[model samples]
Target: MCSSFRSLLPALRAFTAKCPPPQICTSLRTYATEAVPDFEHKPSHYGQPLFQSHPHLLRPHELTPGIPSEEYERRRKDLMDSLPSNSVVVLIAAPVKYMSGSIYKYRQGSDFWYLTGFEEPDSAVVLEKNASSRGYRMTLFSNGKDSAKEKWDGPRTGFDDALNFFKADDALTIKAFPAQLRSMISLYSNVYIDLPQSPRKNARSTKSLLRYLSPPVNPRSEYETVVESLSSSRRKPLAPHIAQLRAFKSVCEQQVMRMAADISGRSHAKTMRFTRPGISESALAAHFEYLCSLSGSQRLAYVPVVASGPNALIIHYTSNNQVVQDGEMILMDAGCEYNGYASDITRTYPANGSFTPPQRELYSAVLSAQKALVGLCTEAEGLSLHDLHRKSCDFLRRELKQIGFTLHTGDLERVLYPHFLSHPIGIDLHESSYSDRGESLKAGMVITVEPGIYVPPTAQFPKHFHNFGIRIEDEVLVGEKHPVVLSVSAPKEIADIEGACQGLLGLEPI
Candidate 1:
């Protein structure tokens, strides 16, 4: 779809450049022998006839069997066990976002992905839970017009292919979602939603749904009434349950996460080797993405942070622009998603492949804090994120005091350690959890223990301390025995990182 649409764009731009807007529309309508609609009034890839051979719509079928039948059956059954009799669960995937006007790419919701494995927007899945039945009943709602969209955009899978290929019991157009809601809602007592908004309704389509459910007579009002009156009986919101499921990954999910970590780790390690005194931060950012793709990660789990020097002070710094200096540190907090699972790891290192005296001091503090926290992440009962987090702050505070950053002894101040030490990591980078505070670190849970010290651009005490930021992070999975760092193979220690810079540079000029 991307390749075909990109090809259509240049031709469309050329057509508009040579002709007036009205003339372009007339030419398009006359050639296609179709009236120009409101949507066609704007410049678009759809306006070009060169892409006629490509299909406009996408099919709701799987590329390959993503989840095995047994796995699907198992998850479906598990959901059934938790639901009440005559329960109906509505799951919708997230719609795509436009980069600017008329260009779109979307990330699917986890729940919707788990159930349907469909990526098409404006799609919804319905699961009927029954006490007597062994496997839950399933239905899918998708786009109707296949060939209609194919001429302008791309090919669609259509209902027949989606039902048979994806093993959906029944499939219908998105229009059917509203039409079928009357019966689907009346029959089932419970409706499950992770959030209030319907997945089938995008930013453009939701207003109509709200109007449909509004008090005034709209013939579709009854359908909305049924859904609204029974809205309180939603299926169990998987706040902690889904977190639990994701915490203890299946073999497949773990493999994907491990692959993501390896790719992301290599990206950071490569940056360490390739970075020099004059390289623009943007080039390094592009190089990091190239390495991520080369390592088999089709998508980055999140935006790559390539902050150099003082830019590292900004937590979510995405604009990789500043020129890295000889002695400044670069903090890169980036990761990739393998399959659908995510891996988030951060490493702060010198741009010149050597840490300065003050840089080494801060780096050692953060590393020591991480090491101390990891020791506490044992299988010991009753230890929670809150407990481990305090331990991290305490360690950091002690190290800082010893190094003369803070005058206070063991008591850490929030002005120093503001953010918490850890967060759950999985399909979502900052994955959903029960609470940010007091959440227990359970076995099978995966988290990132990142401790850092950021000294903003200032001139009070040490001049070298100003405009320098350092953070060391690793993904750790809680085991029955001990904490296992998924990113352990990556160069992290001061010695190991220097070794990687030398050895990796020896092979090729990455």
Candidate 2:
């Protein structure tokens, strides 16, 4: 080590030792010993870092434009053909929110990113789908600059680069969106807008896009919320045409998602080696991001959940405080983003060396259910996400009964098991896709089959089961031949996990 690095080594070791051992970190807790090659004993750079994919995996899409602008022309033609001849479709990038007063993080809307690869915020895209394919054109509207703001926040792509680099037909200052919207709608008979399903301040772009279209517009929200509650502040309705376009993933999209899942697998394994009792949950979160950085991921797909103990019961827990308990299980629900695609994975494991009986039982129940459901991802026949979820729920119901717990006879499905077992996981954790009553399974789709059993902190259950919540999640690619478990590097078997913990205890971070 260099003189400075050598002197700082003690301090770094002290800091890492105080944090949870990397083996048990939420990102890597369930990774089997065999899944991660022993890198500690080897020279530092002999192999890629735990989370980094081989350079061979980083190649761009192979499909090339047949003609100079064929790809763009094809995309533009398809988009225009789907809408009315005289219609305008508007899509906006979601803005970032500050975690505190100054520090902030953000993720752009997948639909917006899919259409335009620009990563900037306060940006909106307008597609004028006109009578003739040749007449069709697209434009982007985004923020210019305020020297004071740029100095503090750093640089942005702005409108000029968006037009020249992103190749939008035209680019305009966001200040002109209102005037442009009014002008565009006057000439067009129909208007389309892409709006989020939730209430958002930055979603004002959707509202602005829709209101300018016309007086009467689509009234349905695009997001699924908590069981029965509806947000009064939900964004303006979605444009059907735009949604229809998003239903199918482009070849480039599938490649990006595949790469994201690959990187996430490594990150999860790296995190597994970092976990131990007495470590703060926040440090684990930091460890997750660190692995993502070590790899080529752009950012986290969503707010990472590093919940430990009873905090794990809170499904969306993001406050990663509290010292991990020796025997308690930590539930981490996290994802990594590359380019713009996302990969989500969740795993629950003991903070100590292994799981207790109750934890094992609950975990095994979820694991069996997940396995049974994922087995359906075969070329011969397969189930849809919602169908698999329902199957998992049925399995959970049976398992609960087998364990002397009965539902519905006493209103079980609703009271005991309330949440759905699976969801689409992509650019969004609860990503966009239909799964309500009768959606069918489709190939080339990505989804998460996460079956969780939440035994609340109540006395109705045994003390051993009280406050214990376990969820095992894997990112899966629905394939024609078989379902690909993208996060396969993480171990789910009880024996494998226990053995991994036993071996990794007291080890230093590699």
Tens-place lDDT per residue, model 2, 1-510, is: 135544665687688678862221223212222244655533322111112221222223212111122344555567677654566676766655566576465555666665665556676787887655365778887765556656665555546545655578898876566556556655655555554444564454333433332222223231111111212332223444444455444555565566566667656555666789999999888888878766667688888999899898788899898899888898888778765567888888788857888888778877887788787855456455566666777788777767655454534445455676666665566566433324565666667778787777655555667787778888776777787776765656776465445543233233
In angstroms, give how far residue 68 of model 1 lies from its true place: 3.5
Put down candidate 1 lDDT per residue, 397-416, tens digits, no spaces.
77876777744442244334
Instruction: Give me the overall lDDT of model 2.
Output: 0.62
Show the lowest summed lDDT stretch of 10 residues, model 2: 222-231
* Model 2 alpha-carbon drift over 4 Å, by segment: 1-76, 93-103, 131-135, 143-164, 194-239, 378-385, 401-412, 433-437, 456-464, 503-510
C-alpha TM-score for every candidate: 0.78, 0.71
